[model samples]
Target chain A: MIFDLVIYVLIGIGLFFNILAGIGLLRFPDVYTRLHAGTKCTTFGSIFLIGSVILLGLKMWWEKDTNGSVLALHSALALVAILLTNPVGAHAIARAAHRSGIKPAQAVIDELSEEPMNVTTDERRGGD
Target chain B: MIDVYSTYLIVVIALSFCVILAIVRVLRGPTAPDRVVGVDTINTIVIVSMVAFGTAFREIIYIDVAIVYALLSFISTLFIAKYLQGGEF
Candidate 1:
C-alpha cells in the first residue's frame, strides 16, 4: 500500500515538473534562455519520471512477474540512456547556436570574441 | 489498487502538455538552431513518455522503441551540430 502511494506521488511530481519545463520554455526570452528552460527542466523532470517507472517495475518484479522484471530493467536502461544523452545533446545544441551567431540576450560582453582567427581554408570553403 | 487507466491518462496528458510547449518553441524560435533544441527536447520527452506508456500498458515493445529512439536522436543531434560547426562530413 505504501509503495503504491510512493509511486503515485513520484509520478505526480515528475509530471508536474515536466509541465513546468514546457511553461518555462514558452515564457523565457531568446534562444539561450529557452534552451536553458527546455533542456535542464526536462532533464530534471525525466529523472523523476523514469525513477517512478523503475519503482513500478521493481514492484512488479517483487510480485514474481517475469515480464515485470524485464520491463523494469529495460526502463532503467532507458533512463540511463536519457541521463547520458540529454545533457550532451543540450551542450551540442548550445554550442551550435553560439557558433551559428545566435547571441545571448542582454549580453554586455563576449570574451570569445577576442580569440584569434583559426579558420582553415577548408572551413572557409565549407562556410560558403 | 489505483486505477491503471487513470495513470495512463495522466501520463498522456502530461506528455501532451510537454509536446505543446515544445511546439511553441519550435514555432517562435528566432534561429534555426533554437528550433533544433526545441525538437531535441521534444524527442527526449517523447522517449520518456514512451517508456511510461510501455509500463502502463504492459508492453515491452514500446520500451525497445524508446531505446532505439534515444540512440537515433543522439546521432541526429551530433550531425546537426557538425553541420552548424561547418565541419566536413
Candidate 2:
C-alpha cells in the first residue's frame, strides 16, 4: 500500500514539473533564456518521471512478475540514454546558436562574443 | 477509489498541459534557435511521457518507441547544431 502511494506521488511530481518546463520554455524572453528554461526543467522532470518508472518496475519485480522486470530494466536503460544524450545535445545546440551569431534578445553585452572560441581554444584543438 | 488507470489519466492530463506550454513557446519564440530549443525540450518531455504512457498501458511497445524517439531526436539535434555552425561537413 505504502509502495503504491510512493510511486503515485513520484509520478505526480514528475508530471507536474514537466508541465512547468514546457511553460518556462514558452514564457522565457530570449534564446538563451528559453534554452535555460527548456533544458533544466525537462532534465529535472525526466529524473522524477524515470525514477517513478524505476520504482514501478521494482514494485512489479518484487511481486514476482516477469513482465515487470523487463519494464523496469528497459525503462532504466532509456533513462540512461536520456541522461547521457540530452545535456550534450543541449550544449551542442547552444554552441551552434552562439556560432551562428544568434544573439540573446535584449542583451546588454556579450562577454564571450569571440568567433569560434570553442574551436580556437587549446583544449578543443585535437581533431585528426 | 483512485484506481491505477485514473492515476495514469491524471498524469496524461498534466503532461498535456506541458505540451501546450511548449507549443506556446514554439509559436512565440522570436528566433530560429529559440524555437529549436523549445523543440528540443519538447522532445525530451515527450520521451518521458511516452515512458509514462507505456507504464500506464502496460505495453512494452511504447517504451520501444521512446527509445527510438530518443535516438532520432539526438540525431536531429546534432544536425540542427551543424546547420547552425554553418560549416562544411
Candidate 3:
C-alpha cells in the first residue's frame, strides 16, 4: 500500500517536471534558454519517473517475484543511459548553437571564445 | 493493485500535450538551433513516455526498446549538433 502511494507521488512529480519542460521549450526565448527548459527539466523528471519503476521492481522482488530482479536491473540501466546521454547531448547542442552563430538573447560578449585567445596571448607573453 | 491502464493513460495524454507544445516551438522557432532544441526536447519526452507505457504494461521488451531509442536519439542529436557547428566530421 505504501509503495503504491510512493509510486503515485513519484509519477506525479515526474509528470509535472516533464510538462514544465515542454512548456519551457515553447515559452523560453533562444536556443540556450530553451535548452534550460528542454534538457534539465526532463532529465530531472526522468530521474523520478524511472526511479518509480526501479522501486516497483524492488517491491516485486521483495514479494519474491522472480521477474522483479530483471525489471529493477534493466530499469536501472535505462536510467543510467538517460543520465549519461541527455546532458552530453544538451552540451553539444549548446556548443553547436554558439559555433553556428546563434547568439544568446540580449548577450554581451562570448567569454568562451575569448578565453582561448587569452590563453594564447599569455603563452606568447611567457615565451617573450 | 494499481489501475495501471488508467494511470498510464493520463500520463500519456499529458506527455502528448508536451510533445505538441514542443512541436509548436519547432514550427515557430526563429533560428535553426531553436528548432533543433525543440526536436531534442521532443525526443527526450518520447523516450520517457515509452518507458512509462512499458511499465504500465509490464513489458520487458519495451524497456529495452526505450534504451535503444535513447542511444540512437543521442547519436542523432550529436550529429545534428556537429552539422550545425560546421565542424569536421
Q: Which candidate is the best by lDDT?
A: 3
Give the poorly placed runs of model 3, Cα more than 4 Å off.
A113-128, B1-6
Q: List-wise, what DockQ does each model earn?
A: 0.62, 0.73, 0.79
Q: Candidate 2 lDDT, tens digit per residue, A33-76?
A: 77777878778778887888888878788999988888888898
Q: A3-108, model 1: which lDDT tens digit per residue?
A: 7688788888888888888888778777777778777888888888888888777877888988878887898888888889888988888888887777788888
What TM-score goes with each of the models?
Answer: 0.89, 0.88, 0.89
What TM-score would candidate 3 get against the native? 0.89
Docking class of 1: medium
lDDT of 3 by residue, B1-89 (tens): 54743576678789899899999999999988899898888888888888778777878788899889999999999999999899589
Candidate 1 chain A weakest ten by summed lDDT: A111-120
Candidate 2 CAPRI category: medium
Q: Kindly report which residue pairs in candidate 2 clash with one another.
A: A26-B25
Residue A7 of model 2 has an lDDT of 77
After TM-score superposition, the amount by which residue B36's alpha carbon in candidate 2 deviates from its true location, in angstroms, is 0.6
